[model samples]
Structure formats: C-alpha cells, structure tokens
Target: MNKFDAIVIGAGQAGVPLAKKLAAAGWKTALIEKRAIGGTCINDGCTPTKTMIASARMAYMAGRSDELGIHIPEYRVDFKAIMDRKSTIVKQFREGATKGLEETKNLTVIYGTARFVDPHTLYVDKNDGSFENYTAKKIFINTGCTPFIPDIDGLKEIPYLTSTTLLEIKEVPEHLLIIGAGYIGLEFAQLFRRLGSQVTIVEKSNRLMPKEDDDICTVMSDIFDQDGIRVWTETQVESLSLKLGKVHVKLDGGGKGPASLNCSHVLVASGRTPQTAALGLENTGVVCDEKGFIKVNKRLQTAEQHIYALGDVKGGPAFTHISYNDHLVITENLLNGRHKDISKRMIPYCMFTDPQLGRVGMNESQAKEAGIDYLVASIPMKNVARAIESAETRGLMKAIIDKKSRRILGAAIIGEQGGEIMTVLQMAMMGKITADEIRSGIFAHPLYSESLNNLFMSV
Candidate 1:
C-alpha cells in the first residue's frame, strides 16, 4: 500500500505544475500518468500543432516569394521532415518534464492508469497487469480530454483522421475535407492548404469560430475564400460514405436537399470531450456532468472536498494555458490559503488562421446582452504601417470600452500577430486599465502592436 499527502492523476499541463507546487511546499505528492508527461500541449496538441503551423507558414511565404523580390525557384514540402521536427520538440519537452519531476524529493512519479476505488483510495493498473493501491489526503484530477468522434455512418470504417492521427501523416493529402470550422478546423485547413492540399471546410455553425465575434468570423471567411479553401457554413453532415479511395459527404442546410462533396481524405475537427470515463468516478463521491466532465467549484474543489478537478475535466476553457492557470489558482488555494477563483481571471482566446483572430473579456454582443453602456472603435489593417509593410493588411482591430468607466471592456483583433496583440489587451482588462491610458502609452512605430494605439485613436 502506498499513501501520500496528495495524489495527482494524469501528469499533463495542469497535473505536472500542481504536483511540483505541492511537493515543493513540503507535501508528499504522487504524480500518476498513463502516458507521456507534459500532457497534450507538450506531446501532441499545442507544441506539435504550432511547430507544423510554422512550417506551413514558411511554405506559404515561399510560394509568395515574388512579393519579396526573391529569386524564383520551385520548392516542395517534405511532410515527413516537418513531422520529424514536431516530434523532436515534443520529445525535448517530455524529457524536461520528466527530469523536473524526478528531481523533486517529495514527489513520486507513477506511470499507470489510476482508477478510483473509493473517495480517498485509488488503484493503479500497470500495463503488465500489476496493480497497486494508494490512499491520499487529497487528489487532483487533470486528465484533460480526447477528440470527440461523432458516429457518422461509415466514419469508423473509412480511413478518417482526427487531430491526433492527422499529424502522423507523412504525405499531404491531395484533397482534404474537414468537418467543423472552429479553431481546430481552421488551423488544420490553413496548414494543409499551405502544404499543397486542396482543403474544404464544412461548419455546422453559420459562422467560422462561432464563439468569436461575427465580424471576426466574416474576415476569416473572406480570407479562406481568397485562399481557395471552400467553406460551407450552416451545413450539417448527414452521412459519409467511402468509394474508390475517396470520401463522399452528404450535407444539408436550410430546406435544401442533400448536397454531396468528394475528397481524397476526411478529417474530423469537431471538438474534444473530457476524458473521465475510465477514471471510475462512480466508485468515488466525485460528480461529473452529463458529458462526463468532472464538476468543480470556484476553487476547483470537487464534490469530494478533498479532491480538486481542473482543465478540460472541469468543463471550462479547454486551452493549454487555461490548464496552466488552473494549476496556479489551485496551487495557491491549497498551499498558501489564498482564495483565487478561476472565473476571476482574465481569459483570452485565439484562432490561428491566415488572419488570426483573438479576443479578451466581453465582446460587443456580450456588452449589449449584459446591458452595459459601451463604445466601440475599429481600425482597418490597411491603415497600420506595420501591416502595410508586411503586406498582410487584410483584417481589422476593434476595441470595446465602458462608456462610464472608460475601462477597456474588450478588444478583438483579426490580422497578423492577433494572438500576440491580444496579450496586451488581456493585461489591460485584468488590471482595469482604461482606454485613455492605452491611448497615452507610446507604441513602437511600424509595428502591428501599434494597431492598438490606432484603435484607441479612432475612439
């Protein structure tokens, strides 16, 4: 029998940091993971995806060498080499995580599947069919999530791909049909399209990135159209059939009859679901929602008071950074007696399409829904010197300000470096910095960050 002051299940982004914090605080901690450490972000999701996106961006730039007055030469994408680089990055991060955990004196890193035997007891199952029992004073669940595979007809029978499997492809598909137009879908669409694949996106929602502001979605739609990626909005996949090395999709919208599209490959970027089914929550007092996500309070404490849940398992924002923030908040509450609620944090989101889209705090629609008196100002990318110099001036930057308080209520950017630019806005919103302050701040000339200055100037 093994016992510890805290037991963390799944050593991913959230679990790894929390385990370290608890152990460093002199708590006896056991970090258990069935797979590699550093979770999806380090191993598969964010790191690898972004690495591949970088390669794809380079490929895009090479194709447009004429704009930069570069010599003309034909280039081919080595998909296998790109995957190799991504793999290398994943491996390096994994090793760093392992070494960090191994050096912690008060922490035990266990590689096994952990299942709840009781509210405070768990059984770890090893691959060799061996089992070990563990009891803890507290437990933290950060198992994260998995791709949600819909049960479309013949989807499983065909060689369908998800984000996890798509990264393993050594050769680019001749034609790729993607279902869903959220972040995942758009990202893969841009990557594969730049890699010389004909990409088509079918989104059930009426707009791309339905969670974002509609104006941003409109800009993204235009960019996709200009890039030759076919986008079908408000379309539902009725069924899928495989024939002659091609995928045939039946889609329906409005009262129109079913329309069909053919493609050499199909990728499902629908969404992800919390990975809680195998944890045997029924054996413990922990409660999960209908979708199998563990329920947690403002402090991330589960129904079992001694247990805490974070990241995607808590059914909140499912981003890698969000999971890291979850670790920070929970660690503070558990170790320092500080009461930090996850909801109180300023959360930002981004979609990495051609003209990236990013937002922080209440958007214009949300301000209206909340009945807040707000003023909005927008600046076109063409007016930004940096955007013009970079020849990527095809988006907009918008700011929402509280009319009474003059505080920045929200800011959205849809242009080059939108994700990076949103960080400045996130800090401002978090610190309650007003729009007038932002306007007074001097910005570097010929930089995309200056768009914020321009946006406030428009106000």
Candidate 2:
C-alpha cells in the first residue's frame, strides 16, 4: 500500500496543474493517468485538430487565390503531409507536457487507472502486472469526458469515426457524413470540405447549433451552403450500414421522408459525457448526476469535501479553457483556502470554421429567454473596409447591451478572426466599459475590429 497527501485521478488539463500546485506546496502527490500524458487536448482534441484545420484553411486560401489577384494555376493537397505535420506538432506538445511533469518536485506520475475503494482509498490497476493501493487526504477526479456514442442501429458494427478517430485519418475522405452539426461537426465539416471532400452535415435539432441566436445560425447555414456544403437540420439518423466499402447511412425525417445516403466515412460529433463509470465512485459515496457527471459545488468540491471534481467531468461548459480555469479555482482553494467560484465567470469560446464564430457573454436568445432588458446592435462584415479589401466579407458582428446599466451584456462575431474581434468586446464587458464608449471610440482605419465603431453607433 502506498500513501500520498494528494491523488489526482486523471492527468488532464485540471489534474496536471492541480498536481503541480499540490507538489509545489509540499504535498506528496500521485498523478495517475491510464493513457498518454497530455490527455485530450494534445492527444486528440485541440492541438491536432487545430493543426489540421490550419492546413485545410491554407489549402482553401490557395485554391481561391484568384480572388486575391494571386493566381496559382493548380494547388495539390498531400493529405499524408498534413497528417505528418499534425503528428510532428502533437509529438512536440506531448513531450513538453511530459517534461514538465517530470520536473515537478514531489509529484509521482503513475501509469494506471484508479478506482476508489472507499472515499480515501484507491485501488490502482497499473499497466504492468504489479498493482497498488493508495490512500490520500485529498483526491481529485479530472478524468474529463469522452465522445458520447448515440444508439443508432448498426453503428457499432461499422467503421464509424468519432472526433478523436477522425483526427488520425491520413487520407482525405472522398465523402464525409457528419452525424451532428454542433461546433465539433461544423469545424470538421468545413475542414474536410476545404480539403476537397464532399461534406454533408445532418443535425438532430430543428436548426444547426440551436444554442446560438437564430440569426447567427441562419447566417452560418447560408455561408456553408454558399461554400458547397450540404446541411440537413431536423434530421434523425436511423441506422448505418456498409455497402460495397462505403458507409450507407439511412436518415429519417427532415424535409425529405426516409432517405439513404452513401459516404466514404461517417464521423459522429453528437456530444460527450463525463468519464466516471469506471472510477468506482459508487463505493466512495460521491454522488454523480443523472448524466454521469460528478456533482461538484461552485467551488468544484464533491460530496466528499476532500475530493474535488473539475472540467467536463463536472458537466458544465466543456472546453480546454474551462478546464484550465477549473485548475485556477482548485489551486486557489488548496493554496490560499479561497473560494473562487466559477459559476459566475464570463465564459468565452470560438468555433474555428472559415468564418469563425467568436462568442462571449449572453446571445440575443438567452437575454430574451431570461427576460432581461437588453438592446441589440449589429454590423455586416460587408460594411467593413478591411473585409471588402480582403474580399472576405461574409458574416456579421452583433452586440447585446443591458438597457439599465448601459453596459455590454454580450457580443457575437461571425467573420474573419471572429474570436479575435469578440475578445475586444469581452474586455469591454470585463472592464465594465459602457455601450457609449464603444460607439464613440475612435478605432484604427481599415481593420475588421474598427467595425466596432460602426456596430455600436447603430445601436
């Protein structure tokens, strides 16, 4: 039996930072990970996908260079080279993470799956034949989540890919059928479409990304339609089958009755669920919600006060940045005994399609649903000088301001560097900058951000 001051169940974004902090604070820590060091971000989620997305974006720009007055007669995409580049960068990041863990004093990195025998006792099933039992005063489960596989007929029997599996694909799929139209689906749909694949997206909801405002969703649908991508919303996938080496997908509902489609590959991007079933939390008396998420308070503490849950495992916003923020909260609690709550934090996220959607604070729909007194203002990218000069005018910038406070409530950007432009609004909201300041603010000429001057002026 082994004992440590702290035991972090997963070496994820939250676990890594928390473990380092615990070790630095003179606590003997055990960081247990069943897989590679970097967890979801470096291995499958952010790093590899973004790197491939970059390659796809460059290919798209080269193909459309005629509009920019730089005509390249032909541009060929080497799918293998793109995959290799992704692999190289992923390797570098994983090695760097591994090095950091090694350098952490009093941090014992273990390769194993940990299950709670009791609240304080953990039985570690190591990769090797040897097994160990560990007890700690403080335990954290940052195991995060996995891509949820929806129960469609004949799904498991066929070679369908998840978001993680699709990243490892070397060949550009001849035809890719995505099962969901959320952020994961849209990003891959655009990336593969740009990589010369015939991409079709099917969403179960009535519209694509129903979480966004109706207008924003409509604009995204139009942009994809213009880009030669087929989108079918209010669609339900009935079953999947293999026909002559192609994936034959039978989808029901939508505008069409029952429909059958054939594709070279099928990628499922429905959603993800917390990874807690195998953690043996049942024996620990820690309660998990109906969706399998470990129930954590605003301070990220579980039913067992000594044990904490962070990141997607606690089932709120599932993003790398959110997990990092979870680390900050947990570290502060452990170090200064402070209760820095994450429930009220301003969460910002971006979807990296061609016309990236950068969002911070409340969208129009949310403010309306909450019955908040808000004012909305918008500016089309076509109205911006930089957008016209760059010939990338396709989306819009929208802001929602609280009427009473005259402060920015939320803003959404769907243009080139949409996330980058949204950050300006996020800072304004953070600093309590009023809507009037943004309206009258003098911004530099000929930049997409300068559209802020016009966006708020119209409000």
Candidate 3:
C-alpha cells in the first residue's frame, strides 16, 4: 500500500492544476489518469477542434480571395497536412504537461484507472495488468466527460464518426450529416462545409444554440444559411440505418411528414455527459444525480467531505476555464484555509463559430426572469472602425446593465474577435465594475476591443 497526502483522480484541466498546487505546497500528491495527460481539452476536445477550425477558416478565406482584391490561381486543401499539424500540436501540449508533472518532485503520476476501494483507499488497474492500492487524505474527481451518443436503432452497426474519431480522419467525407445544432455540431458543420463537404444539420430544438440569445441565434442561422449549411429545426431523428455504404436517417416533424436524409458519413456532435461511471462512486458516500453527474455543494465538495468534484462532473457550464477556476477554489480552501465558493465566480462561455458568440453574467431574458431591473445597450459591428477595416463587418455587441445600481448585468458579443473581446466584459462583471468606469476607460485605436468602450459609452 502506498500512502499520499492527496490523491487526484483524472489528469484533466482540473485535476492537473490541483495536483500541482498541492504538491508545490509541500504535500505528497499522487495523480492518476487512465489515458494520456492534459485530459480531453488537449487530447480530443478543445485544442484539436480549435486547430481544425483554424485550418477550415483559412480555407474559407482563400475561397473568398476575390473579395479581398487578391486573385488566387487555385486553392486545394491538403487534408493530410492539416491533420498532421493538429496531431503535432496535441503531442506538443501533451509532452509539455508530462514534463511539468515529472518536474514536481512531490507529485507521483500514476497511469491507470482508479476506483474507490474504500473511503480512503483507491484500487488502481494499471495498463500492464498490475494492480496497486493507494491511500490518501483527500481526493479530487476530475474525470471530465465524453460525447453522448443517442440510442438510435442501427447506429452502433453503422460506421459513423464522432468528434473523437472524426478528428483522426485524413480524408473528408463527401456528405456529412451532423446530428445536433449545439456549439459542437455547428462548429463541425461549418468546418466540414468549408472543407467542401455537403453538410446537413438536424436539431430537435426550436433554434440552433438554444441556450444563446434569440437574436444571436437568428443572426448565426442566417450566416449558416449563407454558407450553404442546411439546418432543420424542430426535427426529430427517429432512426438511423446503413444502406449500401451510405447512412440513412429518418426524421419526423410536427407539421411535416416523415423525412429522410442519405449521407456518405454521419457525425454525432451532440453534447457530452459526465464521466463518473468507472470511478466507483458507489463505494464512497458521494452521490450523483440521475444523469450520472456528481452532486456537490457551492464549494465543490462531494457528499464525502474530503472528496471534491469539479468541471463537468459537478454539472453547470463545462468550459475548460471553469474547471481551472474550480482548481483555484479547491486549492485556496485546502492550502490557505480560505472559504471561497465556486458559485461566487463569474463564468463566461464562448462558441467559436465564424462570428463567434460569447456571453457573461445575466442576459436580458435571464435578468427579467430573475425579476431584476436592467438596461440594455447594443452596438453593431459596422459602427466600429476596426470591424470595417477588417472587411468582416457583421454581428452585434449587446450589454445588459442593472438599472438601479448601474452595474453591468451581462454582455454578449457576436462578431469578429467576439471571443477575444469578451474577456474585458467578463472582467467587468467579475470585478463588479460599474458602467461608468468602463465608459471612462480609454481604448486603443482601430481594434475590435474598442467596441466594448463604444458599448458602455452609449449606455
């Protein structure tokens, strides 16, 4: 039996940081991962998807060279080269994470699947078929999540692809059918469409990205229609089957009859579920909701006081940065004996589409739902000099402020560099800065971030 001061299960964004902090604070820490280091963000989810999106965006711009007053003879996408570059990026980040762990003298990295043998004991199943027992004072569960594939008939038999397997393919599909209209689905739809694939998206919701603002969804739907990506809203997928190397999907709608779509390949970009099944939570006192997510308090502590849950497992937003913040709160509570709750932090989320969408704090609808008096201000991208100069003058910047206190309630941006510009709004919301402070701030000339200044000025 091996004993440690802390045991971190899963080496994803949350676990890695927590382990490093504990180890650096002079604790004997043991980090366990069933797969590679850096977790899903570096391996299968964010990093790889963003890299592929960059390649797709470049290809799309090349197709519009005529608009830029540059005549290109011909442009061809070397799919293999793009895949190679993405692989290189993932490998580099993975190696860097591994090296960081190795440098931590007080941290021991274990590559295996860890299950709770008891409240304080963990049984590790090593890749080499050997087993080891570890005991620790506290544990952090950061196993993250996996793509949720629906239980459609014949889906398992078909040679369908997911975000995980699709990233590894060197050849592009002739026709790709995406099964969801959330961020993941829309992102891959745009990417494959730009890569010359006839893409069709089927969403059961009334609109794409239903979680986002209605106006933003309408604008993005228009952009998607202009890009030749077919979107079917309020359409239910009844069945999926393979017919002569092509996948056939049957759909049903409220006012319409049954419809079918035949495609060369199908990609499931539906959302993900928390990866908590194999951790053996039953052995511990920790309780999970019906959806298999760990139930935790605002401080992220599970039913077992010493065992904390973070990231997707704790539910709510599943962004990488949120997981990192979870690590900060947990470390502060453990090391500095500070009392900071996870809910107190301002969480911002972004969808990296062509006209990226970002939101922080409460929006107009949310504020009204909460029965709070709020004021709204909006600025179009065309009004910004930088957006006009970039020749990508589309989308809008919207701000929601508390009418009583003049505090920035929430802000949403959908335009060029909207993702980058959201950081400032997030800072204002988190720091509890007022609208006047933002309005008085001087912004640099001819930059997209200037939209923030213009937004508050109008308010």
Residue-level lDDT tens digits of model 2 in 254-343? 667888899999998999988999999988879998999989888888999999998889988889999989989988877988879887
Supply the TM-score for candidate 1: 0.97
Candidate 1 per-residue C-alpha lDDT over 1-459 given as tens digits, one digit per residue, 9 for 90 to 100? 798999999888899989998999999999989988988888878898999999999998898889978966989899889999999998998999899999998999888899999999999997667889999999999999999998787788789899889988879999999988878888999999999999989888778877767886687788888888999888888888887878888888756657998898899989899999999899988898999999888889998989999888889778888999999998788778998987677778887776788888888889999999999988888898898888888898998999999999888898899988888888888888888888888888867887677788899
Candidate 2 stretches with Cα past 4 Å from truth are: none
TM-score top scorer: 2
Give per-residue CA lDDT, model 3, range 240-331, as digits (tens): 88888888889987577789989998898778989999888889999999999999999999999999998888898889999999999998
lDDT, candidate 3, residue 113? Answer: 95
lDDT of 2: 0.91
**True-vs-predicted CA distance for residue 67, candidate 3, Å:** 1.3
Clashing pairs in model 1, backbone N/Cα/C closer than 3 A: none
| Root-mean-square deviation (CA) per prediction | 1.3, 1.0, 1.4
